[model samples]
Target: MKKTLLILIFLSCIVMANNLPELGDYSSSKISENEEIFIGRQILFQVNQSDSIIRDIEISDYLDLLGKRLINASTDPAKKIEFFIVNDSSINAFAMLGGVIGVHSGLFLASNTESELASVISHEIAHINQKHISRFLAQQERASYQSTFLMAVALLLARSNPQLASTTMAGASAGSVQGALDFTRENEKEADRVGIQTLNNAGFDVRGARDFFTTLKKANQFSGGAAPAFLQTHPITSNRISDIEDRLKDYPYKQRLGNQTFHYVKGKLKALLGDKSNTKNILEENIKNKIYINEAGERFALAYIYLMDNEFTKSQEQIQWLFDNEQSNPMLSQLYINYLIKTNKVTEAKKLYIQNLNFFPI
Candidate 1:
């Protein structure tokens, strides 16, 4: 009876393999697409730790606007690029299965210009355009099938009282997990190639990809433990930077500067990063240099810094300026409330807090 049951199970496995869907065709189906998006959204939500939701929206809209322009310019117009700006300050961006692309807020600030931002977006889009996700999925399916076979055999053994099934299943699962991660390195390389082309095709500065990676390398060294989540998945390397430079030589594109959005976002991001002394130093320099794009951001930084430094009087003044002059930004408003409380103006702080909650109801 055991032999007969084993034979039946083997046959069933063979039948499943024969019916296994082609990755390309399977991914085309709506159900497959939805599953990918769902997974991407869940992963994004689970990892978010930022206190500012408004900042996320600001960057998300900016990236989407830029991404749309680039995606529209692609040779294959049917490819869609969906953008999300995550709250994490990590210098990372990720493209999940399907067209879902996410950028960490830190990535926005880390970039020096629009081209740098485009470099990251282009890389992610390249992943989708190259069908990297589908390829990875196909590889995963094979490993999963192998794992299932091993688990089935182990279950059969356990039924006979050996009780090794759980251990066997766990080992097989670990192998499958490692296989998925191993395949990601290949996917990243493919995306890097595609990203450069996307940048060139979209009329962005061709050197931007190399430059962004270079900056990220420095940032990784500095941040160490606080490194962005993106680096954890896509390891940076000197070879990769060299490869990007080599690829750019083949595409002799004209140098065109990026847009206003890049400057705006970059400035805002810097204000979020530093403490009072650091912010004041940067802000003073920016003001002296007449860098208006970052002016509002400098103000926001100064306001937050004063609040943190326990100068309630100065904090109140700065917060008031932000409240009066800046647009309805949630983070700036939250900063104001925080500043008010630090100053011992609890009554005023309470009112502002209530107002903030009303304006940005959770």
Candidate 2:
């Protein structure tokens, strides 16, 4: 029965891929937009069922806000885009079918500024907008549903489990489908070109693209080993960074401040996902040494840790300090709300929720 089901799925995908439009007279072409969306949705359904996704509302909202800003600045503003945060700690982001983009939390931990994160996102968005994946598929005249299915599975496992991804790739070798999965150098260069333009249009610092790629190149050089998964997939070279730098010369120099939310989300991820004892120790050490430039962020992170540890009074104290300092951040407000609810102060939580709604109505 299972074998029969798999055969049916394969037949359906073959039909779908065949129905896709041809690449025109050009050597390269793309699947239809509708087909791309369909494939994306199928992959996304699998992704949703996996343990790799981060389902936090706050993190989701922040990523959506940042992603939408970049998407709005892209050449096609009307295109629907979906953003997801993968729980993996690997420094990677990937664009999938149907304008779906997945960002690993490690990407956030690796990025020094919001612009750095945005730069990567913009690049992925460029890939989707340029239909690079579809074009690659079009180039594979004998593209099969089996190959496509394995490609999606490989990508889903890439950041979360490289070993599994490698195993899947080896299995896919039965069909010689690996070549269908790689983006061409031309596609990479085009994405870089259009991505920086999108960053600039989005009012982010374009230097971010250069700086982020440069950092990755340097890290890859010093690792004394195989390239990281991100570099393995994205394949950064010295020329890529140089090209971005050259493009930077055309844009007016502008210094954009990093978003406060970026720091907050980073802290939250650390407290929530990092080693518990280690996270507590690090927060304590930072507090003791006064190490953070943004002390409120430190306190906010500590409060989250405290909440996780069930040190209710300590959590309240930290939250109160943030409120006292007039931090007024939505994240902090949510923390306060959570605290109130936890302490059985439902009335207070309700009142606060009403006040927050009044201040920032949807």
Using all chains and alpha carbons, the TM-scores for the candidates as numbered come to 0.58, 0.85
Clashing pairs in 1: 90-228
Model 1 poorest 10 in a row by lDDT: 156-165
Supply candidate 1's per-residue lDDT for 345: 69
- Tell me model 1's lDDT, rounded to 2 decimals: 0.59
Q: In model 2, state the lDDT of residue 155.
A: 47
Highest lDDT: give the candidate number: 2
- Candidate 2 wrong stretches, greater than 4 Å: 1-30, 143-163, 173-177, 180-182, 214-226
Give the clash count for each candidate.
Answer: 1, 0
- Judge candidate 2 at residue 276 and give its lDDT: 79
What is the total number of backbone clashes in candidate 2? 0
The worst-scoring run of ten residues by lDDT in candidate 2 lies at: 1-10
